[model samples]
Target: MKILKRPAGLILLLLAALSFQSQDGVAGSNLLFYGLAALALIIFFYIVVSVADNFMVIESKQIGVKDTGSMGLFPSFREIFRPKKPEYLEKAHVYTLTKGYDIPMAGEPREEIREPKVTRFALTPPDFFGLMPIPKMLVEEGDTVKAGDPIFFDKKLNRIKFATPVSGEVIAINRGLKRSIAEVVILADNEQQSRDYTLPAATASREELVEFLLESGAWPAIRQRPYNVVADPDVVPRDIFISTFDTSPLGPDLKLTVRGRMDVFQAGIDVVRRLTNGLVYLGLDGRGEDPSPFEAINGAEKRYFRGAHPAGNVGVQIHHIHPCGAGENTVWTLGVEEVLLIGELFKNGRYDTTRLVALTGSSFSDPCYVKTYAGANIAELLSGAGEDIAENARVISGDVLSGTQKSTDGFVGFFDNQITAIPEGNEAEMFGWLLPLKPRASISPTIPVLSDDIEITTNTHGEKRAFVVNNDYEQVMPMDIYLTQLMKSILVNDLESMEGLGIYELVPEDVALAEFACVSKQPLQQILRQGHDTMIEQG
Candidate 1:
């Protein structure tokens, strides 16, 4: 027997011996004891074998996409439990957004203005922790742009444009104080926008393809973590990871989405392969019945994971399989559709612009799909979809648990194409927590009594606090990195300790759930981002 299996077998033998000794007194018969012992041993071995099979330590022997470094997501529980150095805190850059009424964290709730419907558009600058200096306007109020035209291009010619995601004339431009670009309003150009156009296929090198992607707005979908910067398509990543699973509420169905888009995804994989000499690994949901699209691709490797929310996360996946290191500088991750665009760009010369966004949530009148360009307006996308929504409701670009709260007037997130609309209901319960949770309520370990096996509705039936639980560590986290310790390190500005704790393996979204679940209302992402910035600055 192999070294590891031998111990397990020994354990079984010991268990059998114990069973034999225990049964020695039964019926004053050694024959009865032997039979019972045999049964007990069989049962014990069955359970042990099942557990080992489920928690198998899969090694990466070949150099396909699945060669995980020390930085990826699949370390064993023993390895994960090993002690590591601690991180310290540092001064952070904090940007506060408009907060009106405070849903009391502990005491009296603070009051603020209540609008019938809050519609505002706020854009985060493209660079990490960047402040937008009077954004240079590329389109005048009266100019007409084709579906795929540049509206704002940076000095490097990395353009940010609007394709009339819903073809429309520029009806209004809402500029804030000192002519800060607030929102660009368009009157839906029905005929022009309604026409569906597909890209014509063509082949190009990785560098040329990246430029084409930037020109077409597809590069925004490929987001890099650590710095939370969008990947510079011009540069090669050490490896590429494709995630076919999301555990967030109302998350996209990768299997359904990837269906029929395999060719485009293949093209995208081909392009990504060109950029990295390292392996490409595709992460599949362990719960999934079907093989992942990456398995269909020639060079990619596949890993299947089973567990709770963060288990399916790409950050966690990367950490388990292959960890990032100094020489293995950068690793890239993307969703299934984003990969299709890569293939679409090479197979067809044009950029695959419109993203397939799922419109789902309790606030939505109907759950559906919308074909919209990147950075399109949420108002336009939610126009007809909010038919059943309550008067006072919240609409977010991503899942309510982890997604940023965007104003109704805000544009869709550059990367998140999903639309999540949920009701901000008015019924105030006398004691909300005391009441029995409905089957629809979404709760994890902190809430307790939330049965693990039950399939509940995607909506968060619980109240939304700025933060309500101190779940910064193991509860919501499924990664190997010690989040609480890492956050402390970032706060105290401990770079070396942070590195030792695998800080480079994390991004804002990796900790977004912690923020959402925090009872203290701590800004988890901000802290993580700040820690990352401090590390970069120190370097």
Candidate 2:
């Protein structure tokens, strides 16, 4: 029977009718050889329960300490995992937090703010346009620049460049509306100089550490995953990752932004392990019980990843460890505060750009941590730090689910660390979606919300209907793709089913929790940034 036209030849024709009905004695009076040995033991226990439900490994009994120094009520992770010692297992893996994410973790950052007073910084130019396109400028408007100079470069990957965070003068380039380059302003002088170039990160060479991180603009702090962009100095990636924890909501704590800078965070993990020869990994935040000065920093491979709000999204730990298919290879990542600002520019040869940020929300009256620099001046770091802003609040700049809405006199986004602010729902709630119990803040547990400290508002509260697939983007996307078949292959622009539904694992803040659990409020991070600008304008 032509070997039953193959399915491994019909599983060897049902194991030769169960081995000739067990040696022709009519094994239990053969009912077609007992239905071919119960359909080969139900396809071998359905391929061992679908490979143990896709390689399940969630153990965790203890380990989840996220109170990076202060800020009142912000516990959960079931108050740091529980069940203590028995020779420690502590595995991790949870991911849920998509319930109307109003998680402003009560304004953290209790201590460290060191010496933040900048004056005016700005920069922006679409935060270094990720990887190329929109670059050009090179100083225009009274020009003076100093703290690392080169105010723009990539006219098409012109060795990248883009510098300037402090050494003042070039007053305002601004631009916008199709002219593009918005915000280049500088102005900060009080003795800031800084142009040096040194190097010798323990004997450079990886082409002199990628030409000293593309001539000191710290090579756009290394992004590259199929299209997170900026890290293609001839692509030799395959694994770098980094993360170092930020669990989203009001994220940003890399151990209180690298406090006391563990020897510049282990000299930025030995200068990003000399730009990859593979394996750097480093995730962290598997809750906590000491051990993490970024797990005593030495040459990464740490991992951990506890739970909630994109478990510190390093592209969901590179989709649970190395899963970026579609023309593969590129991996890279970086952000443990931009690897301590590229190990403080190869251990202080200059270009520091400071950092710390945080600010936070629920319309801050005093949300903390500011030290500033990368485009500092969100109304001068919330002037006197105890904000009141309101006029329908909303500041943003980064985090309140993938930030950006700026304008409290904007500027603080070159890869923002956190600013937020909140409140701008635009009123009008009479019946508020046929109330079933609503105070707002919903990932729809059939609408019951009264308060998870309700304050978030850019209110969609339902409208842009249509695309309903359900299970709310796989209950807050713990990534393995298939978030509504990759948003229906990015709403049918289907570049080969959006790279076979992975879209190089994804970004737009990993689909901002599937666009905050979309019930078709589909903007879905502007359709994954228009499928990463249509795969970078069709290659």
Candidate 3:
């Protein structure tokens, strides 16, 4: 029994068990003898595995891995049979998400960043969630304002300021349903004007840094979790998360967005680090062996994730890294572009929200990156591309799967970096559901997917139906939460069960793929958002 821990001893024990043929040359109780032999082999195999784990630790240390615990060659047998984590979730910071659905859409942007003269831009209050129906306007119609000048402030949270993206005259303050401020349109100046803020010190107090961000109209860049709203100024977040890449269909290569802007990115990270009491985590693209630009970014912790769409979602990254829980366990997330904007704000003391917007989808004549401000006019952007955008084409402010729909006159979303234009599915294809012959995007075997880049239109094909229980949600959604159950809870307004089912770990984009994969054609994102509102209202 004492010799069971050693490989040599296990081998001898195995030999003894296998060689002990009951002395009667294997009698009628051969089943027990066979069991004894199997047990010995299993023990020996576990011992060999223990030795391998020990060797791996030693080898890791030899290569200067200081934190690899226990370098003992003949390690304990328990190491082999220890209940390990499931393959989907590894113990390390690096993750290889196995379950997710990649949407193939055409046309993808070429490896070119186009600098178009986007003259018109707007700041729509509705673009941001959790803001009041109407924010108190700082500048009105025909008011001349600089880039960093305050446009409006939330009535409840007066400290957080929303700034204009460019130096321009406020041409219109469009009102929507119920006199709510729809958009504050600006006729941008050719030679842009900007406000020069005082850059705070690297070792500045949290109050000083927060004050600078608030005053510079960059506070909206730091959004809180659970509600996915603009974080309050008084509360320091538990942690901050940033995804260095995007995996949504026709998503911009974020690396390109921040190209030659590493210094600014690092400075932005420094400011972000001071915003949170805990660590600032960066979720990097781990599919490639090459190091990301943010790998060298200082003052923040780095984590790697490799998988399909939504893997690059900061919410997913947050869920895996340090999931948001109940109470004041608040967290915040920012995009790579937002980080660069923050960096620029602090580095140069200017509020520059320059966007490298990816114009993708089959509707455009040239699908490529366009450099513009945050809320550049869609019509100007499309016309600048020298492509006559079809009046019927459905333009989106972001990716096709989860982006906000927009018209030619619509402005780009504040949080969006990519603009997608796809063909509208106004006229349904005859027998399209019965025989899905078109080379389109679908995880289901029904639609013949020939490549990862298929032309997808805005058609659902099928209407919403009874929620059928199947493996659909699990196949596409890699999170540990049961989406089917969670969606049901949301549908019924069961807040208690929603929290228990990991609702805090989700945002609308996190379940966009799951919604796409649902056979019922459920409006999952809408449902989830409603649930979030319910939770907030109850609280």
Candidate 4:
């Protein structure tokens, strides 16, 4: 009876007893029957324990810990009997983008912008010119325009229009060579009146929906993969990918951003579902304690990804689930905030560009968030805020890795929700590279031991050199493509080789990690952008 307390011991005892009986010339039929019964009892006990474990009083937060503890044996059995969580079958092939000095801001408490008092907005043209050429200016200097009025229109794609965020008079139209518009500064009027449009969500055809999005400036939210350009109205995408969580250093918290706006987020999901005949895959943070707010969203397949940076990238998510092939109509990808913007447009019949923007960096006195429009002036937004940014500090419109560098007076990017301020590393160090005790961050372990609190700067620690093939770039690059080979193809203008190496599957941001990890300090993103532009031009 005591032996029965231990299942393994009881099984062994029964086997020994059965063998003894057989040797003593006991009935063979009775011996066989008892052996079968013992085996059945062992299996029955296992099933009961596994079922009971599911009902155990374990908190969701403690699940990972308890499952790895001494009591973890029961959970293992449960895993065997339970269905696996839905995820990409392909192993996530990527390296950590965070360098030794990239301190994580995830633990910092999120502060919301209480009352945003922005008086000026700038419509930057360069933000929209990724792969496509600059759009033709539609508004002149000192011209009055409504909130949803078009400021510029893409000449090649006439349907794509760039709208202003506020109703105001265009104070200045800054232009560069060839009369290309640089930034159109607008002075916001106290009386904000928006140009209203009719909501067609309930009864509009797919064609109607597409046309409305293109004209209303909501179509830019959806970006096609091959060249990472604006989604074409004529091509129906194979699928749509929405990333809810961003794992970039000092990235905006999506959960906090969409706290009370779940309804809008869900509405956005519905509209996106209608656009694509194929499946709409929504990616969320897999390591969270509670279920993601996006889990309640319907009409889309929810896939979870748990890892470091680029895990939150929609391109990474697409690669794991379904990759883009050459000559294929690319899949469209959108961020959670963009989806909410699209949803708000359909619901309100006017463009609502209000977003939660985070001001972060080691240079900030109190890093916090702000409630501002897409094209709000960065300087005006941080005017009264108690920041410790230096005069020469760099103000980036997005995360440090993939964001664009801008001046303090520059405008926030249309697609950016985070602004980082860091000191410019312009002072040269004597034998800095030779110092083995400096606390600066470097991806290479051969360098000096870096302090975790080290303030990262624009310094390329090392100078640009000849292209060297090393494991550094490949280690951080998670995509299945050959990164070094692809870079070489792009460098040599080998379009066919680049296509064969899965160039269509990449964007500038996708190769940003490789750029950071490269010892050569080469601008990988710029090279990829050139290749992307060339491919589009050749076509």
Best by TM-score: 3
lDDT (10s digit) by residue, model 2, range 475-539? 67776577677666877788888877777778788888678768778888778778878877877
- The full ranking of all candidates by TM-score, starting with the best, is 3, 4, 1, 2
Sorted on lDDT, best first, the list reads 3, 4, 2, 1
| Model 3: per-residue Cα lDDT over 1-539, one tens digit each | 45555666666665556556554454636755665777778777776766687789879756755334435555455545544443433443566576797787778889887777887899989878999989999987889999989999999989988999999899999999999999999999999878977777767899998888888898898788887888878887888888999999888898888888999999889788887779999998876656666778888888888777778888888776678865678888898888989889878878899988888888888888888889999988878867566557898898888899988889999989888888898876778887776776778875667777677888888899989999998998878899999999999988899999988888899999999988899999999999899998998
Total clashing pairs for each candidate: 49, 6, 2, 2
Residue runs of model 2 more than 4 Å from their true location after superposition:
1-119, 122-164, 169-193, 201-270, 275-278, 281-312, 322-373, 376-393, 404-407, 417-423, 435-457, 460-474, 479-515, 518-539
Stretches of candidate 3 above 4 Å error? 1-93, 446-448
Q: How close is every model to the real structure, measured as TM-score?
A: 0.66, 0.32, 0.84, 0.79
Q: What are the per-residue Cα lDDT tens digits for candidate 1 across 1-539?
A: 23234345566666556655665565546655676777677667766764554344243324332323222333444445643311210121111111111111111111211111212222333321222434456667666654444455444333532223334456566677777555555554444423233443345555665565666645655756556456655557788888777766666665555567777777788777766778888876654444444456676876665555666678877776776644347787777777876666567655445466666665555566655555566775566334344466777777665666677767776557566766554556456556644432323434544333232233333543442324445556666567777777887887888889878888777777666555555677888878877876776
What lDDT tens digits, residue by residue, belong to model 4 across residues 102-147?
Answer: 3333223256564467888887777765523357889888899888
* Candidate 2 lDDT (Cα, 0 to 1): 0.71
lDDT of each: 0.57, 0.71, 0.83, 0.75
Q: By the TM-score metric, which is better: model 1 or model 4? A: 4
Better of 2 and 3 by lDDT: 3
Number of the candidate with higher TM-score, 2 or 3 = 3
TM-score-wise, the better of 1 and 3 is 3
The CA lDDT at 220 in model 4 is: 76
* Clash pairs for candidate 2: 60-91, 63-287, 64-287, 64-288, 65-287, 65-288
